[model samples]
Structure formats: structure tokens, C-alpha cells
Target chain A: MKVSSVVWLTLVWVLLWGTFTPLTLVGGVVVAVLVLWVARQAPSTDRLPVRPLRLLALVGYLVYDLLVSGAEVSWQVLRHGPRACGAIISVPLLTSSERVVTLMASALSLAPGAMALEIDHDAGVWYVYALGPRGASDVERTWLRTMDVQRRVLATFGTPEELARVRRLIEERVA
Target chain B: MITDVVSAVLMLAGALSCLLGALGLVRLPSLLSRLQAATKPQTLGLFLVLAGTALRVDLKSAATLLLVGLFQVITAPVISQIVGRSVHRSGGVRPEVLVVDELAEERPQDRPS
Candidate 1:
């Protein structure tokens, strides 16, 4: 692994788990910095560049959706019964990167009614099971739209053209 | 004591939401729908639980709890995205209303060799 990748991973680990123990903190910091140095020597330059304002908006939207849908699903299960639930829908993806794809999966899964089950990297697809009043078509559309938002956000970090191309590809495949 | 009561209530609510979400996961028909059930309640439930814990605990632990919450808020979506896209790419059918398949166009080589 590149030093940069290692560094970033370490930094993330420390940031997330540093509170667990002093040893973890020390180890995380040391390993992270060292890995970062190695990553710097690596020669891959692809990055997802996202605008800050848009990113914030995306986060806000996700949070709101999470709350609303969480309540909706909970209410449905409580009032109507589980039989009203919808079917599993498979969503094809434009982006192939693990980070972007996983982010998409986690986001959907974290929502109220959906659970992302598997990721087929070769096919660039995500399988999600959503439970709600919506039909299969509606669910698929929602998933696509949500992923579109993520694609746009990813574009902000570095390569707009690449992101656009990815978007285009996903659209074509679905068509 | 009042603060403790509030904390207890929040914790209970959080637990309820979590339970509801888990139930939805079991009851939901589709994987996509289940994903919906799994993500939201877990996030909110966890947030509430953390908040309640913070209310009842020391400052450092509270800070840690908040940090964990923030992490969940950040990473949850990313994970969903990955899973959703993978499902789609795996030949999941799309709605008729959809007009385009961008991913397909982008990768001509994705076709079978």
C-alpha cells in the first residue's frame, strides 16, 4: 500500500478510535504518519473533489431523510404489519471505486427502510432491500437518485469529467 | 435527577427506534427496502443513545460519544452508496421511467470478452 493510503487510513483509525486507549492513540498516530509518508511516494492521483457547500447540503438531506424514513418504517411496522413491505431491488452503479460505492451502500442502508446487502464490483451494482409503501419502480428510482447525489459530491473532489463519464455510463447501462 | 430522567427517556426512545428498525429489517420484503430499514433507525437510535449516554456520563466520554456519532453520520451514507451501486451493477432491473444508463455508456469494455 502507498504511504499516503496508509497514512490516511491510520489517521482515520486514530480519529475514530483514539479514545479507546492511550496505546491505540500512540500506535494510530505513529502508524498513520508513517503510512502517509509512504503514500506520498505512490503515484496515483485520482481524487473525488467535492464542493463544501454541496457536501454540507448532501449531509443535511441525508440526515433529514434518515429521520423521516426511520419514523415512516417504524410506523408501518407498528401499524400495518410486515406483509406490506416491498421487494429487493438491485441498483447498478456508475462509480467503481470501493470508497464511493461503499459510501453509497452505507448511506442507503443507514436510511430507514433500506438495507444494502451485497456489492458486485465486477458488475458495478448494489443490491438493496427496502421496506415501505413504495413499489419496486419507486424504490429503484429513489436509489438511483440518491446515488446520483453521491456521484455529484464525489465529482467535486478532483475529476469532474471522470465523474460525468461515470454518470453517463451508469445511465447507459440502465437504459 | 431531572437530567437523569430526560436521559433515561432519550435512551429508551433510542432503544425503541433501534428495535423498530431491526424489526423492519426482518419484515421488509426486498433487500433495498431492508437497507432502508437498517440505516435510518440505527443512525438515529445510535445518536439518541449516545446523547443520552453523554447526558449521564463524564465530559470526556460524552465527547467520545459525540465523536462516534459524527463518524456514523459520515460513514453510513458512503457504505450505503457502495452497496446500492453494487446491487444495481449486478443486473438489477430498473424502473421504466428511467431514461438513461450512464454507467453502461461510460464503460464500453464492460461487455463480456
Candidate 2:
């Protein structure tokens, strides 16, 4: 496998293993760092040039969103019946990079009351399920806005053209 | 002493929220709604539980709980999205939606048999 793939896999492995076995966790970390270094040195198309500050902001935003949404879902359950919730919405993604697509899907899914169900890599689309609000338009608007954040997050590592394509696709679908 | 009381309160609240969320998951009408009930409260509930536990536990256990919380925070949305998307793809119609799906229009031949 390519260095980048190895690096990504090692990082995933470390995250997965680190929670359990201490010895394997240390080894996983070492391998992850080493593979990352090697991947950085290797020339590749999948290279992720991330903006650190922007990434930090994105992380902060996600955390805040998760907390707020968690509370909202809790309140909804407490107040009204969960039956009041609505349908699943499919979000079309713009970036073709596996890393970016994966990150976006996972991030959105991790948020309270949201799920990343399916991804069509070829079409650059994501099917998301979110708690429906009063109006369908409201749900669509909220989802599109959230997707806009995802687009910006992906743009940090990808080209403007790619981001523009994603934005355009989203606008075309939502509008 | 105050911290202990605060921790206990948070824990109880978290546990209650989690139980409510799970109940909602079963009570919700559609798959999408159920997912909403399952994920959102569970995230906060788990976070609260973990936080309370962390306060009462040692450094290593706290670290483990933190990792678990982070993992749940990260993975929950992805799983929900996957499930939601599948529901949409599986011919689950949105009762209140009015807008015509352009992608559905563009792909006339790929409709499920």
C-alpha cells in the first residue's frame, strides 16, 4: 500500500487500539507517526494540506454543535413525542477525496440526532438523516447550511475549484 | 464535597437523558426520527456519564472515558448519516417535502426494480 494509505490506516489503528491494550497502543502510536512522516515525504495526489487554525476552528464548531444538538434532542424527547420527528435527507458532497468525504460524513454523523447512512463516492453524495423540524424547507435550509460548513472544512485541504463544485452542486440541489 | 454533589447530579441527569433518548428511539415513528432520538441525547448522556465518572475515577480511567466519549462524538453522526441515506435511497418518501429532487430526475433508469 501507499505511504499515505498506510499512514491513515495506522492512525485509525492507533485510535482503535489505544483504548484497550497499552502495549499495542504505544506501538500503534509509533507506527502512526512514522507512517505520517513517510507519507509527508512521498509525492502523491491524496496529499492533505490542512490549515491548522481552520481545522481547530472546525473542531470547536463541531463540539459546540454536538453539545447543543444533544440538548435539543433530549428536550424534544422530554417535551413532545419522538414521533414528531421527520424524514431522512440526502446531502450531496462535493469533494472527491476519500479523506475529506470520510471526515465530513463521520463528523456530521457524530453530531447528536444525525447519522451518515450512505456515501456514493462516484457521485460525491452523502445521505444523512436528521431530526426534522416544523417545515420541510426549514429542514432543508438547516441541512444545507450545515453542509456549507462541511464544504468549508473540505476546502481547507482541497482546491477552490473542488469547493466551488461542491457549493454549486449543493445550490443546484437545494435551490 | 460540592464537586461530588455536582458530579452526582450530572450523572443522574445524563442517565435520565440517555434513558429518555432510548425510549424515544423506540417510540419515534420513522427510521429518521428514531435515529434522531437515538443519537442526539445519547451523545450528551454519554458525555455526562463519562464526565461524572471521570470526576470520581482515577487518571487512567478518566483518560479511557474521555477517549470513549470522543469516539462516540465522532462516530455517531457518521453512522446516522449512513442509515439516513439508506432510508432515503430505499424509497422512503418525505411526507412534507414539496421540492422536486433534481438528482432523482437526472437518473431515470437507475430506479430500483
Which has the greatest DockQ? 2
List the global CA lDDT of all models.
Answer: 0.63, 0.67
Every model's Cα RMSD, please? 7.2, 5.5
- Give the per-residue lDDT digits (tens) of candidate 2, residues B1-113: 98799899989989987897898876666666777778877787888888888899867567667678877866776666666656556756444431333334444432344
**Stretches > 4 Å off in candidate 2:** A1-45, A78-83, A88-92, A163-175, B85-113
Global local distance difference test of model 2: 0.67
Model 2: per-residue lDDT, tens digit, A26-134? Answer: 6776777676666674353686786898788778877787677777776666665634654345666777777777777666665545556666677766655556455
Worst 10 residues of 1 chain A by lDDT: A80-89
Residue-level lDDT tens digits of model 1 in B6-112 = 99998998999899889977875444445556777788899888888989887755766867897887777666666655655565534222223334444434322
Error of 2 at A130 (Å): 2.4
Native contact fraction per model: 0.37, 0.51
lDDT value, residue B111 of candidate 2: 38
